[model samples]
Target: MENSTVPETKKDVLKMVHKFKTTFQRLLSRENQNVIETDYEKCETNTDIEKKVFGTQKDWMNLFEDPSEDAKCNQFAKHIEDGLKEAREKHLKCEILIPCGLTMRIARDILIMSESEPCGVRGCSLIIHLQEKSNCTELVKLQYDPTTVSTFEIHLTLQEDTRHVVSVRKMMMQLTGCFKHSTYKSTPKMLCLAYKLEKQKLYRANC
Candidate 1:
């Protein structure tokens, strides 16, 4: 009987190699396509999550762009209180409301940095530096029409630190211009003018 096994040809070997290579390439391309699709889906999911959290892209960016003043003030308030050394260690806590025209509009968002200064006569002084938003100047211009100046700073001084109540009261009066019995353009004169007008109308009707 003759040898049953036949010798493999170079052409046959080359064809087998090519087939294997083609199969491997197809698998590699499919894997790459799957990876790209997965990444795209993940990015879309992140976008949706962000939209749910912040409502919109502009609103999300604003959280980082605008200054958080209320949070800063709340952080500062904690350090403002302390204990004093006496026979018994007494704790002194001060609650303060800063009244200023600068804070009227941007009170929540305006950045305030405060430092304590020791005064010779008064107990202490709190100097707060303010920074408004980037477009604050433009916003103020659009909102207000000033007579002499577009923007101004006011300095409020008190008789002493203990007289904060009196100082705040006086400042409130000056800023808002509201008093219990304050007359606008003279109330008596306005009433007299009204009476004269009424009398003249009556006389014309009689004639």
Candidate 2:
């Protein structure tokens, strides 16, 4: 299969995860100007599993404070809440398209990447498919270029002066802001954000 094609099956998905891990690790060290410990144990274990066992391991140690000043989880939560409150007052609609099979994973990724304390995104990506029994047609798109490859684009639209568009833009900016600072030193806060995300997996499992 061509590398450009995204995998849909479990086996192919596992392959993609391995590939992404290699690329992401290289990017992490080079971009952050700091070395992120690789999950060598995972690499070994993953090799032992059957191709059908495509799911990844649950490692809580990964979510640690990098070197940032604030808690990434909190920052992400705030980002989501603030964006939604701003959009709600103006009645704007928002939508986000994350990687396939990576909805929660991407959310966790955002929490770590934001590296800000007390963040949430409930209202930011809420899609209004139907409003007052009417269909909405006015829409804008936001895309996050992860792996330096953009595949998903979220379309959002609003009908009134509710400043919905502005909110969407704000959320997108926050989510994508870290890429420009890839070369900066990792802060303690950044590591903590990563840690929280890994720990939260237990809580998220039931949801």
Candidate 3:
């Protein structure tokens, strides 16, 4: 009888997967139908930069899921925002080696974050923290909820990390699961990152 139940459970799981695949395909197909459906970079990159500099204007998503592309993007963006904040508090600068070019030195100060509502939106207020603040620019959005705690957003005018400057937001947001938690005595914040500059694929964003 237990073995019979196992097959039924497998069938149920398959049904769910089928539903998900169908829905995803439908949405993707509709997106593809546009006469000039741009590349995935176009699909994922932030649409605006100047208007998005604050980081407090947005939440993680509009209306769809935990691990969907949108969800993953938000998670990664939150990670970069929080990591930079933590790293800055402990060390004046956190060094990120460019894939092949110069190193980026990010600065963080204790004043960067607070237990209460942050001052003047983070991306704009903290423009002083980025290494490329001049040649390139940034915008950020942050959201906090009694339930979700915190989720952050960033838009950049330069491509220090990816093909398009704004596209880096997707890479940053791709760091973790679309659904996550921080219940047990508060979760960990990264104070350091040490990705090897030469071996791009060896680590998960280094540290």
Candidate 4:
């Protein structure tokens, strides 16, 4: 009886050790997984910080460079040139419009027009070269189709004179009307406005 009892106790001890080993392995795996997740989070945070710091490095470097007569204009032209290239690659007609500066009312009107359209009509696209109050240029793309337009809106304060505001609003209304007409006719038309250049010429003539 004593001999049999000893063997049974040995078996129980072995079983206990095996259970402990399995538990330890599972806990270790869970700890490793947690560590991996924490490291990934840290990596993502660092990447975002790096992007914020380095994204506009060219603009920052330009501060020390000698300024040219057409440096800003050239930069704006380059952005437009690139936009045109992209449009060509996509086999879509592109129109470039300049509203002088984006205003809240103009933006609201654009949003309303865009939301009124349908979706997935691969007809034409719009490239907006927006010049901000700070003289910074931004490229905005809008799908100009019968079905749908992009809903992205850039918020900006109205800083232009009353006359300028009225002109811009008129231009927007005309463009919106064009969109509506195209939708009714099922024929999308490319909208183009060189308003800024024309306005500049008028100013020069007045001077």
Candidate 5:
């Protein structure tokens, strides 16, 4: 009787271990499914927000190509406004690269400039002055002068080893400076401008 009871006890212990293992696996499978569902929901939410902010892909493409239409221009301006707001809220630094040529023309139109001037320059004198003030090995900083309207102050410093790229700081919501493209022969130069969007007024006001 004792020998028979020992075998029965061993069988009971084995059944208990198998039940626990199966239960743990089921819980793990449910947790994984929940994670996947949550990720899918987040992805759907982001897609909806993107669609709301920037219409369809074709609409955005057309807007970038030709911002001559007031409605399209307003949409682009709103996009920029959203970006600025998001950056501020997230405490992020934002930078915009305005390439030379057709894109630059579109930017000028969006900024409501009368003439198709590169870097939004009203005259050649300012471009010449900026080119003269710039150096190859130094980082140049340009900021709007408070004393004079549209006047900029230039600051230069030795290029550090870590500073491989040149960037304009403190020129928020305005054209900072124009620089020659380091690479790419087709595109000769590019403009650094951070725009502050003012909806319908963006077409009327100069930045």
Candidate 6:
């Protein structure tokens, strides 16, 4: 009777151990199954910190996202407008590179004059450089002045079909009228006003 009881006890202990082991394994498997997998990537050339962190293949994006291509394009335009504002603050003189996305024959605006004439004078001139992405570093100059503002717009509209448009507008400068005649640097004021108007316009347009 003693030997029989000993065997029964050993069997019971072994069964309990096996059951505990199975339960532990099941728990581990379930936890592993619920764990989410994620991946991320970036451009080969981009060195910006934001680019590094969220450049590609993100498991999560911002809380907000645009659902449509037109929305994305409009966002891009807004970004460009913001960048121009910063450029104006720095008094940065740079060319305006028109992207290929613009439709042909869209009227563009500019002030131009000849180099020989003073900027405020009637015959003053300004130069514009047009180039495509391939030749971005090599700017093709387009000369203009206050008198030819409309003509330049027409030329730009017509050239859209033939060539990529690049804007050579600087951060801020005057070309004609009483504003040009004033000796005071008016780039900041102009930039601020433009930014305010654009912000309102774009916000309403998007709305």
Residues 1-207, candidate 4: write the lDDT tens digits: 788797456545544653464355445534422111112122333335323332333322222122541253344334445554464345333333322211211222222223222331122244444333455343445544437443332222212122344446546766778445331322222222111210000011122
Deviation (Å) of 7 in candidate 6: 97
Best by lDDT: 4
Cα-based TM-score, every candidate:
0.14, 0.23, 0.22, 0.18, 0.19, 0.20
Candidate 2 per-residue lDDT, tens place, 117-181, comes to: 12222212222221221544322222222223322222222222223443464456657773354
Q: List, residue by residue over 1-207, the lDDT tens digit for candidate 3.
A: 788797456555544653575365445434422111112223333333212321212221222333453444354345445644554445434333222101121111111121112221222222212223244323232232324323222222223333444344443543463214322222222211212110011113225
Q: Give the range where candidate 4 is weakest over 10 consecutive residues by summed lDDT.
A: 197-206
Give one digit per residue, the lDDT tens place, for model 5 in 1-207. Answer: 789797456545544653464355445434421111112223333345334433444333333323354444454344434433443333322332321222222222333331232322221111001111243322122221223333211121111111113323222213433323322222122222211111111123255
Off by over 4 Å in 6: 1-67, 93-207
Off by over 4 Å in 4: 1-69, 91-190, 194-207
Whole-model lDDT values for every prediction: 0.24, 0.31, 0.30, 0.33, 0.29, 0.26
What overall lDDT, based on C-alpha atoms, would model 6 receive against the true structure? 0.26
Model 1 misplaced regions, further than 4 Å: 1-67, 82-207
Cα TM-score of candidate 5: 0.19
- Report the number of backbone clashes for model 3: 12
| Ten-residue stretch with the least lDDT total in model 1 | 190-199
Tens digits of per-residue lDDT for model 6, 1-207: 888797456545544653464355445434422111111112222123223332322211221233452343344334334444444344334322232222110111111111112231122122212222233221222222334332211111111112111112332233434345443454312110010000000011123
| TM-score result, candidate 4 | 0.18
What TM-score would you give candidate 6 relative to the actual structure?
A: 0.20
Q: 2 or 4: which has the higher TM-score? A: 2
Reference-based lDDT, residue 109, model 6: 13
Candidate 1 is scored at a TM of 0.14
- Better candidate number, 4 or 6, judged by TM-score: 6
Tell me the TM-score of model 3.
Answer: 0.22
Q: Give candidate 4's error at residue 142 in angstroms.
A: 13
Q: Give Cα distance to truth, residue 192, candidate 1, Å.
A: 44
